[model samples]
Target: MRLGGRRKSTNIQDMRGSGSRNRGGFGRPTRRVRLPSGGRTMRSSGGGIGGIVLLVILFFVLRSCGIDPLQILAGGGAGSGFEQMLPQSQRQNPTPRATPRTDAQTEFVSRVLAETEDVWNGIFQANGRQYPEPVLVLFSSQVRSACGFASAASGPFYCPGDKKLYIDLNFFDELEQRFNAGGDFAQAYVIAHEVGHHIQNVIGVLPRFNQMRQRMSQAESNAMSIRVELQADCFAGIWGYYTEQKGLLSRGDLEEALNAATQIGDDTIQRRTQGYVVPESFNHGTSAQRREWFARGFESGKLEACDTFNNDV
Candidate 1:
């Protein structure tokens, strides 16, 4: 990706070292699918909302390019789910303790956010809607969000309650080191995926899903969450499409992003962590599902092509 002269987003809040550490661990139902507690549904692509590689072709492609995808997959840390716990009564309203600071990684994230802002802002305007840029909150190991408290272990997420993105820069380090899914585009995919969640919130998809999820059974909710998560992946792909159009992508950028998607797929994570599969418990789609949706968006670059709800995800 060509990020040399890109403008970084100013809508950032730096709160590193400003709060107590989160002794909190991953919530129940794994660390990947903690829905918001207050029914503030977050939704996009068509309905709602990775780390490494699973394909042989990807393995060869990456290897031929001098990047061993498997080596990155061997690292331990791997969780890509956002948290949505604690009732509204227990939620804390966090105040920023520091202003934006442009370190190397943060600047990369900020510029990616800016790019998304450019694409979505234009897309929204074209659709006769206004795009309200979301804030990206950078924290230490732990941080408080309107949705709930999160640890870097649980990965980055967007909270609909506050309309802001919460992330620990360390998570990106983990994405590459621990998850073996290193690359600028991979990191961008992670950010774009979270931004996709914000898009759902903006388009009223999440709000509607939140209301409906209250009555949904555990299995039903899980099924619905898969759609939501896949949609976000597609939305990220849409951003990728636009980014490529601007001549930002290099030779292996798309594969790197797809590699990250497969690395963090629900099935792959389960296989690595538990040595078994639980199809019924999957909230995020499988590895192939994730790669396909992202490619679909990248190929079509159309919002309508990302309708994960009405079609097979």
Candidate 2:
């Protein structure tokens, strides 16, 4: 993406590399709390009711991300069916302490997130809704969150309980070198996806899902989750749509996001990690599914068109 002249968002909290050392042998402090089955919900509180709306939109998106909700309910991470593959110890807890980053990466991520804010805020206002900017927490190793502690190994995520997006800048290197999803737009996609979750939270989709999860069976729950995730992917595309319309996207930028989305699809990640595919357990959808949903939003650029739950997406 060509964000050269775009204004950076000030709604960022740079905590990269600044993790607590004395707490664990790994020298990483968990940024979030691990309360097991009943962890606190992340909330968007830095702003007012208008901002809260934006935060809620993202929160609901995080809940399912198109994962099998039943699998998650059976011991999977509510919003992280894929991430749960990693051991609990590997996740970071955001208890700010020691940081190993050189500070440059922190600025880079902050700037990118800031740019997302600019684009999203503009979009919300154009649609007659107030855009509540979410905070981006940059950390290294581990960090604590309102939801619980998370490790860098757990990857980047948006905590609905706190309405803050957590990211380890180093993950960018991993996305490129390890996952083959490189480029600035790939990085931007990750942020956009999380912001997409923020959008869901603001619109009350998350709370409803959480309630539904309580009443649904495992298979049914998973299906619901898939719907949620696919929608987030669509939402990301919506952001891309606006970015392109605003002339912020350069050639190949959208491709970078598509590459990222494809690379991280449930099918791809499952194949690489488990050596097989379990369609029922598939969360985040297949590479094709992800690409399609994102494209839908990017092309349509209409929120009404992003209703993955009701549509054939």
Candidate 3:
């Protein structure tokens, strides 16, 4: 990522270091369960019918609250993914909190966001649609979102309700240290992935999924979610396609991103957390699937090529 002279995006809102109590509790960071960090650090693999039943169960669980499970699951696993990525502790009572960030890292995130704005804006303009720039909320510990309260524990996510992407910069540290997926491009992939969710929301994919989930069986909904998440991965690759054409990617950047997609696959996360793999319970695709979809979008650079829903995985 040769972002030497790139400009920082002005859309970021810094809410670090501020804390307030809510009816549920005080603002606190999500409690991250410190999982051990030894693994292949390279690649891995994950399946089928019972998955649909699991999806239905999750939908009812989340719908009990105010969340539309399908919309939230549009990017990954049902509630569990949210729980693992963003802890329940922080969401209990979100308050404003900020931490000191290295100037270099913040600047790097801003540059990536700026590039996304330019690239997506261009794509939308070419299609005769206006691009709505999403604000990147940079917070530490905890922050509130339209989807609900969040903590860095949830990792980076886009809240469809609010149309904003929330990122805890510290997650990047974890990405580098634990996943061995370090690099500017890895970070960009995170941003682009979330922005990809925003794209889903803007195009009504998310809302439609929410509606369809109401009439679906658990397995059917989860299957739908797999497509949704894979599509977002493809969208991120599409963004990467444009960025690469703009000469921003350096030699190892794509490798870093590919490593990242594999590292965060549902199978890899499950194995890391529970010491076993459950294909039926899998939500996010396997590492190979993620890498393949992203590569498909990046190489083809055509929106029509990103039809993960139509392809049999």
Query: Largest TM-score belongs to which candidate?
Result: 3
Which TM-score value belongs to model 2?
Answer: 0.75
Per residue, candidate 2 scores C-alpha lDDT tens digits across 18-37 of 44222211222234321221
Per-candidate TM equals 0.75, 0.75, 0.76
Worst 10 residues of 2 by lDDT: 37-46
List model 1 lDDT by residue over 216-255, tens digit each: 5667767767777787899899999888887889999999
Question: After superposition, which runs of candidate 2 have C-alpha atoms over 4 Å from their true positions?
Answer: 17-102
What tens digits encode model 3's per-residue C-alpha lDDT throughout 127-230? 54666777777777777777677656666777777677877777777777766778889889988888877776776666656765777666656566677778
lDDT of each: 0.66, 0.64, 0.65
Better of 1 and 2 by lDDT: 1
* Model 1 accuracy (lDDT, Cα): 0.66
Candidate 3: list runs displaced more than 4 Å.
19-101
Question: Relative to the unseen true structure, what is the C-alpha lDDT of residue 280 in candidate 3, on a scale of 0 to 100?
Answer: 62
User: What are the RMSD figures for all models against the true structure?
Assistant: 14.2, 9.7, 12.2
